[model samples]
Target: MDIKIIIDDKNIKTLTYDSPVLLSRVIRDSGCGFSFPCSGKGVCGKCRVRVTGCVSEADEREKKLTGENSAFRLACLTKATGDCELFLPDKNITALTDGLCSRYSHSPFGEGVGAAVDIGTTTVALYLYELENEKLLSVHSFANPQGIYGADVISRIEASLGEEKEKLRALISKGLEEGIAELCDKANINKEECKTAVVTGNAAMLSILLGEDVTGLSASPFTLADYFGKTVNINGMRTYIPRAISPFVGSDITCALISGSDIMKNEKLSLLVDIGTNGEMAIKKGDEIICCSCAAGPAFEGTGIRMGAPAREGAINRVWQERGKIKYSVIGDKAADGICGSALIDSLALFLSLKMTDETGLIKNPTVFEGQPAIEIADSGVYITQKDIRSAQLAKAAIRAGIDSLLNSCGAASEDLGRLILAGGFGSFISPENAEIIGLIPPGTAKRTVAVGNAAGMGASAILLSRQALEKSEITAKNAASLELATSDFFMKSYIDNMYFTKKD
Candidate 1:
């Protein structure tokens, strides 16, 4: 039977299943953005959907989760028996870096136009550069359709080994193709004129796109990955996938080095943290640059919380304490949909200040509530649950621990750094003060921290434009060293000690 899925106030599409299937499976196969924080274990009720046709009865868990009076069904627990229409409820996400970018000019040697792309696990940004004229033809950004498979590289790797690899490959290819077409149309340029695309992503994404076996990249001792390091045709365009340094440290970080070379000059103690699902960091001490990848997961990007989402319309991106009352700011100047990562970090800190969450990261409200662990926000069915706190704890611990590990690698401490660069969009949106309060960033380094928005994309554009930038990326990849954090005892100890809302006393 065919199930018609309709996003509220958006387009509609119909898909088929040969037999009865879990709604979560159907949704996963659809390549749409929906939260499965518990990996569809039904423990987290984030995947709430409204169905309007033949569907099986909601179980006890669903009733307890959404209440008997509510019409929403847990997509993870519900089963679709017949043709039904369902709508996924999430504020439309329109995310691109608002942080200042390093300067770039499209100066490719050839006359043809080129598309520079940075395919993040959760988002994708494309820069259409006019090579000869050194002009930016157009820019387009969108969610990575493969996000439906999972939110992190680990999950993506598991799915890629099975039949789902082709689905992921096709989704990303289609997104790239559509983005190119959209940029060309927006700039009134012919599609044929754009014959080249320079793409950079982590090993998982690159492996899937290049149709290479990802076992070496995903399995234990993950030190192997194929960078292709050559040009190949993908969706009618000659795409150049750059050389990667390791399974975890991808070409994206190599590009970031090119973008942040100003701060990365020799004889300087600097740290670059590209915060994302994968926390990729590079610490420069003199001539050598040590890089490490921490599996930070997607909690920082707002994918794992009960009401978590991207920084978009209605997402509460900031929070503050005002006259003994907490105040918050939502993106797009709209009603609060969910608290984004930056705000969530701020909220955690705020809660700690207000004695809502203790130093041990436990929520203790003065007046007891039915949901023992959740702090309800404005009674709009939005909340920061206990699970959300634990997710933040894990993610922050990974990132902070990774930073400590990197610093240890270079025989330097956080106080020795002259500068700290936080790349990627998430890094830019975050307030360093709030981040420090929550122990996600070093407290002493807040003053010198700089968030260069989407440095990976900026570097990709530079590589597309200038010969020097391209050659620099190559050298950076060749010279960079990757550290395995899981093998470090200090990282493990730091992770355990840093799992609280505040630093260990």
Candidate 2:
């Protein structure tokens, strides 16, 4: 039977299935984009789809989850019995392709054109450069098509261990190829002109793309199959992927460090935090750099929240309290549909200040939003529920705890840091003061905090344009030290302690 998946009434994808299967599995297998906040656990109820054809009737659990919207079924729980048409929400993700790039002399490997790619778990960015003059031609980005399997790396890794491995590889491979074509089209150049590329990403992404065995990444010890500091063929293009620092901390951080070299020169002890699904951080103490990664989850990226979203159109990105009234700014100047990470942090700060939420992250005076106890925005339908607060709390605690662990390992404190460079898309929009207020970052470090948006992409571009940058990336990857946080008692203790919002002195 054929299942037609319609996205926002315009984009459509049809998949053929033989037996009745879970709608979530069907969607996952179809490679269609859908937000599985809880990885299709059916607990979040965020994967709501309208089915018009043969489908299983909603059970008690599904009925309870769907509430009064009986017409809609949770994709995770519902089963597709026969040919059906599924109406899905539009996933117009806003990817961060631009970053703070430092200029370097042109010393590229070859002539013509080249592409530099940052393959983030959620988004992938490609930068095209003219190798002859080292001039940037165009930039392009898109949601990682592998997201249909799951939201986090763990989910993707599990999926890659099975028959769906090739599907996963092909999706990213095709996405990058299309992005390269798009860049060439916009730049008025032939595809043949782009002969070389540098692709940087986490270990799992790199491993999957290269079609390497990833069983080592599935369990403890988390052995990395390949360090990947060499050149290989990627869909017929000669691609160079940078080396990773650790199993969790991949080449993305290596590229970020390379891009931010100018910013870390003066600081004796500088810290870089790449806030994403994995809270990857690096502490450069003297000439040595030590790195670590914590499982921060996807809460910061708006996953697992009742009314959370990425920094996209209709998403709230900033929030502030003015004269006892909560004020917010939305992306695209549109009506608020959901609150993103930066706003979520700001809201927590504001909530704490107004005594709306206590130190334990409990809503003091919660109102009803979507039939659940939530803090609703006045006039706007967007709201944040208790679960959302917990999700944010876990993510923040993990990040902060990881920072503390890294600082402690170097016999240093937050005050000892001369610079705190925040990297990644979410890091760029966050208010340092608000982050401190919510205990997402250390106190009194806001003055030193600097957000360098998408440093990894910038570094990848540097590698594409300059050989020195590429050489530096290779050296940094070889020298950087990786720390295991799971065994650290300090990390475990600090994680629990950081869960409680610190009282502002």
Candidate 3:
């Protein structure tokens, strides 16, 4: 039956067969940006859409999953049986980042075209920018295909240890190929026309993408095959990878160091923290910069957590007290779906402020509030379990520990730092107040903390667009002194001690 679904006052007509297709897929095909974390597994519950007119009974699974009134349905699980109107809530519509699509339009230096890539554990984002006017031409992003094997890099590393190594390589390669093709198509240019691509990712991701054995990276004597800058050809696309400082710390940090050049050059001591699955940190003391990395896991990126997701449409990204009431903003203003990285941080911070969560990373009282939906339940307890707190604790601990270790390595204290540069996707979404309350960053660092949105990607783009920038990146990578946090006794102790929401001054 053909049906007309009215979303946000716009009538969308489509033809359907017998059974219902996933409302998420339907909306996505209809040019609606609906985000589905967990890849529409009905686990995220972020694809909620309201149905008008007569509708079928809610399935037991969805009923138990959402707990919303009968009218609301998980778009991933729902099917269309008759003509009906669907309403996409404001919270479900993801707002596009300003200037992201225009950052790479014209080349500053003639005869130069470059691409910046942020090779994340769960998502890969690319920006095509022209060097001339620093105009962004197009932006492309997609779920990291490597996620099919497992959600985290550690899982992928373990899987690579088995016969699935080839599969891992193919997975990363396919995603890069697809992303490159999309960028080229959108920019109306040939692959060859793209003069260079600047790539940034963790050591494990880089190893996997290059088809290098990463067994050493997983265990002791952690050593990378190569850390120095290298240029490789992938399907005729010239790609430059910054010289990795260590096994766990790869070009991503090096790129950040380059993009945060101003901070690094400041005479005053500073700290740069790029929080992610692999937390990378850098501390500048006078003319020297010391760097370190810790395994923070993928808790913040929406893995490990039952209903967590990346910052996408329908994912809750911010939460605050609006006139003494809890209010939140979703990535896409469609509907209340799943919690993204930012939302998880906000939730933890809110819980802390409300005394619902203790300093020991314990949720004192776990209950779904009225009007809010419950997304997951397991033997580990209900939504936002103690286990989730522990997971987030580990993540925060690794990041904080890295910061502490870097400061100690530089023979300086947090107070000595004049500025803090927060880089990467985690940096962009993390609220200063929330970060400070959870102790992810030091107390006074937030005031000096400047969120450099996607510094790795921006740095990569800069390198691609200018030969001077590429040389600077190479120099930055070379100067970086890599500190292996796993081998440090202080780091281990700090990681354990900082695994709480308490202050560690």
Q: Specify the highest-lDDT model's number.
A: 2
Q: Per-residue CA lDDT of candidate 1, range 1-505, in tens?
A: 8888778767567889888888888887787766565567776566778887788898778887677767799898988898888788753555454333355444573457889898888788888888887678888888777766666777777878889888878888888888889889989998888988889888788888777788886667775556555678888887777778778888888888887445566367998898899899998888788999888888888877767878888888888877867777778867786778888888888888778888888888733333546886544445888778898999999999999899998888888988889888888888888888889887798897988888888777777777677777788888888888878999999898889867784
Clashing pairs in 2: none
Clashes of 3: 35
Write the residue-wise lDDT of candidate 3 on 1-505 in tens digits: 4555675687756645466655665564554334444456676555668876545677878887667465578877887666666777543222112211112223333355667787877667788876556667888877676654455667778878888787777767766777777888899888667766777788888888888888887678877777748888755667777677777767877777776444656789888787777777887777677888777877888776766766667667777666766677766556755567777888788878877777886666555532332322222222565666787888998888888888888888888878888777677768888888899888777787777767777667666666666677678777778787767898888888898788554
Clashes of each: 1, 0, 35
Please report, in order, the local distance difference test score of every candidate based on alpha carbons.
Answer: 0.79, 0.87, 0.70
Model 3 regions lying over 4 Å from their true place: 1-112, 131-135, 368-383
Flag regions of model 2 displaced more than 4 Å. Answer: 8-13, 261-263, 369-372, 503-505
Candidates 2 and 3 compared by lDDT, better number: 2
How well does candidate 2 match the true structure in TM-score terms? Answer: 0.95
Which residue segments of model 1 deviate by more than 4 Å? Answer: 8-11, 16-18, 25-39, 88-91, 98-110, 366-370, 377-381
How would you encode candidate 2's per-residue C-alpha lDDT over 1-505 as one tens digit per residue?
A: 9988887786477888899988888777666756676678777666788888999888877877667657789999999999998888777785787787776677886678999999999888888998888788998888888877778999999989999899889989988888899999989999878899999999999999999999999999789888999999997888999989889999999999999544447457999999999999999988889999999999989888877788789999988877867888899968897888889999888888888999889999899765667898655788888878988999999999999999999999889989899998999999999999899999999998988888999998888888888898889999999889989899999998898888233
The TM-scores of all predictions, comma-separated, are 0.92, 0.95, 0.76
Of 1 and 3, the candidate ranking higher by TM-score: 1
Scored by lDDT, model 3 comes in at: 0.70
Q: Which candidate tops TM-score?
A: 2
